[model samples]
Target chain A: MSLSESTSRRRKKRANGVEFTAKEFKRQWILIAIAAVYVIYGIIFYYLPLAGWIMAFQNYKYKTGITGSKFVGLAKFQFLFSDAKFLQVIRNTFCMGALNLIFSTVMAIVFAILLNEIKNIWGKKIVQTISYLPHFLSWIVVCGLVHDALSSTGIINELLVKFGIIDSPFQFFASKPWFWPLVVLTNLWKETGWNAIIYLAAITSIDPALYESASIDGAGRFQKMWYVTLPSIRPTIMILLLMNIGNVLNAGFELQYILGNGVIQSVSRTIDIYVLDWAINGRNMDFSLGTAAGIFKTLVALILIVAGNTIAKKTGDERLF
Target chain B: MSINTMKPKKKKMATEDLIFTIFNTTIMVLFTIVTLYPILNTLAISFNEGSDAVRGGIHLLPRVFSLKSYKTVIKTEGIITGAKITVLRTVIGTLSSLIANALLSFILSRKRFLFKSGLSLFWIITMYANGGLIPTMVLFRSLNLIGTFWVYVIPGMVSAFNVMVMRTYMAGIPDSLEESAQLEGAGYMTVFLKIISPLCKPVYATIALFVAVYHWNSWFDAMLYNRTNTKYTTLQYELQKLLASVTAQGQGGGGGAASQTDATVATVIPITIRSAATILTMAPIIALYPFLQRYFVTGLTIGGVKE
Candidate 1:
């Protein structure tokens, strides 16, 4: 059946340009028809809501709706900047984000390098599989484990007290100082193995010949790793770092939300939580304020990504965009 | 002295290599232990007597084994309902999203498709920018998706990230196969269903695992869009509530003070119940983890790295 149709198509192609164009148009239109479903879905779900950004500039009330709400240019943004709570939230977000980014990157790189040094294939595979298990777990589950480990009666406190490091179990979660480190440590524990896979792949893809030459030059294992392995994967490292820099604002919502209590809320709240508090929380529902904060986050994220890509392009040819 | 045949130098290096190997192996063992300890500890605690577990000596094994926590968790009305909803969402959400994304990606991957770049650009922008929380909620409300089951499956059906991943994978398939199928008079849908999809199994497994795991693990949506709707609550959300209440109790009683009395703790869902529920929630992902590990690395590298 297809052979006959193809033959007819060929004959038509030879017979007239107009007919061929018309048939071709029909073929392409089917593709367009399929594309239309998602495109329309995208407009409704993704793009159409962008119209709600207008709420940011208005004293948006549920009764008045977006159109009828009184327009108050720059007021919401000004309030957000002036509010000490918002400023603290911003600081918390940046600190936690930077901490996670720095430690996770460094730890993953180090882990990957050390993992590559393992000569036993089965051992390497087993360790890697175990390491990635946490990444697949939900933040709630992870936090459950963390809380179990850090609870006054939990293992960490037990060990600490047992070893005479402390006379009593320490409150790891209750204190203000431990929050940032805890966030960073949790992120590292969850992400290091998963993130290391990319670096490991880069290491595997590095020309074995480079290592051979380095060995010939009397470079020891550490020396070869330093000179050959690190340099070879520099591009991968830079690309990942740039991508992460773009996502810095994400400094994690689920982890914080799951683990945070009233005591730790000051340290744990991120911009996302700020948005949720104002927009969704019943008592604090300020649509305009939430929209303004959300808009600020979105703008900063876009700027960071674009800037990171531009920097990547300038430093090397590894631009994400 | 060309070192390829230098016995003395090789012997000297062998000692250093052995030391390095031992060191590396030790670190890996420690890392593995650190990673696995908490999970195993949780399992142990879950199985141990709920009252005894609060005393906190359980490590790798249960000192006093009991199925009481699991029995309690299984008996909970919310958890059972949440499990049903979770399973339904995972099955339906994964299938629908996979089909929708695969179709859209197939169109985008075609070389001669007229809207390829335009549609590609449209989807890509959605990846970078979104209308934030309030607006998205407002949109969903206006569309009457709020408090509906469809909110879980529909809003996420056509994610740009998934589309991009699938598109990149499809674009790499040799065009000759698709062209031959076309010459056989296979329509676009037929070509996608028969030719492209069968060949795209690895990517499909990768994506299926991705989407399925996401649906299973997602609770925020349940909390956000369906907060008031008890009918659509998910397992994770229920677990979240349990966790919150447990933590609150822990804080209020100053961590184990309440657990000092078995009678007082029996009324509240203790840590053991939380652990049992957690294990139940994560059991499916753990069961399918081997499949995930097998496909994700290759799949992610293909879809993510090249771009």
Candidate 2:
């Protein structure tokens, strides 16, 4: 149905209700109409821009809109595959995603495990506060902070110099070898605390009696922790891991966008950044290529989510569904 | 205030607990240091004299600290206008969002509500599906909302996640409260407004903060459609321009347009100026975080567990 027809139907629905009058429908509809507006907004803004997807099918012209543009059809897609940068971005997205997932989960689990071992309430709370703080920082801020620290004359280089680790300051940002690792490590540092929170909550929920029973059986501290705490939070870990698998394509847009200067340009350009640069950043909006990129992202995200959900269903665990 | 101090008698600590305490203290201190470093560095750079920051002189602390960057920011044209616009958007956006979320969530929370499953599934589908940006832009243009204030506020006024959270919280509320209110001949609106909304103070506050923060932090809508429309640019978007454009200018790609636009002396405090803008943008959000952190662990923890 068109937007107006839907509004009329909404008016009908309002009229039939007990307290609803035709006038209240306008007010309630103005309020309840937000849903319709949301749907309409999604249709108008999100979906309709997709019609420009044809730009991918054509040698798009800025003077003429998508309709007036020449029809090329699958040529852009073919050109994309032929482009060597496509392979690098795909590889970069996956490799970075994998590292981020592995590092974040492992660090979170470790932090949660160690936190569980802590008896001092105030101390544990402090750790929680401090660790979670980075999660709140915008990538803009985080990148600025990183620039300050990792620049040649920054604290890290100074410390390295004072300790005589290097003859001269090195440009870490320029080093290809350090690019991916730095991205992963900084991500781990920012996310581990926030990510660990869910696990910590899960860890706390695990029955204490299990640990007490293990202790009664003469289980040592290590043995009890291994046999109890780790096992208890396993399901939570799996769920998050599975969820991460679905989000593997989202190797972060902001961080890559900011940190990716000309030095690490080849390795750092993920799919999202590619879309922003080619589609949004440049002089002419390449709606077709941009839509194609968005479609690829959407399709990959959908497939991964369904695949993960299916796996989750088979395992008989909690799923986003 | 001293009531607990004088009455406390069991001050003894367990031996195992003592070791654990030390271990935990060390962990907390280490993590705290990690968390504080970046923020402290940013703040320090923001406060540092412009030239010192450009030369990479500041570290964990400022060197010959100065308020020049902030002075430039405050004196810049349209800053108060930007701040006023941001504050207004946050308030109106939160109000409309809260209303829509509360109404929808309340309806969906009831099993007896008409078309509950279907309507909810519609929202759930929205999480996964989109028609792309071109169509959306066309639709908004057709609707005449492109250059209007409604463009920002209407499109994103309600979030599915907030709706789900509020619904979960509403489900937890006893039906007896509503039943008794109905017995007093109150309508659904009255019952909801009088009883449920008040009872949901914590949840409301949490969601309000979430929506408010989202509005305050968002520069995307403005970036997408507001570049030419000087009146519609939010504070975050304007600050983003101040931050990003300066860098673009310094790279000689844009010829120092941004720093020159400020009408202040073109000082070479590039990093310091960027840091200053960052701090100003994040200040209110960071301040609000600690206050509402209780909700993250308490009321909002409902859907986190599977079983």
Each model's interface RMSD (Å)?
Answer: 8.6, 7.4
Model 1 per-residue lDDT tens digits across residues B221-307: 998888778899999988877777666565553332111211122235688999999999998888888756878777668777656
Return the top candidate by lDDT. Answer: 1
Per-residue lDDT of model 2, residues B58-93, tens digit only:
667888779998988777665566777789898999
Off by over 4 Å in 1: A1-23, B1-11, B252-268
Q: Model 2 off-target regions past 4 Å?
A: A1-72, A281-284, A314-317, B1-25, B52-60, B78-81, B132-148, B238-268, B304-307
Fnat for every candidate: 0.51, 0.24
lDDT of each: 0.83, 0.69
Q: lDDT of candidate 1?
A: 0.83
**What digit string (tens of lDDT, one per residue) describes model 1 on residues A139-257?**
87888889888988888999999999999999877777898898888888888899999999988898989999998798999898889999899988887887788789987687777
Q: How well does each candidate superpose onto the true structure, as a TM-score?
A: 0.93, 0.83
Considering the two chains of model 1, state its CAPRI-style docking category. acceptable
lDDT of 2: 0.69
User: Best TM-score goes to which candidate?
Assistant: 1
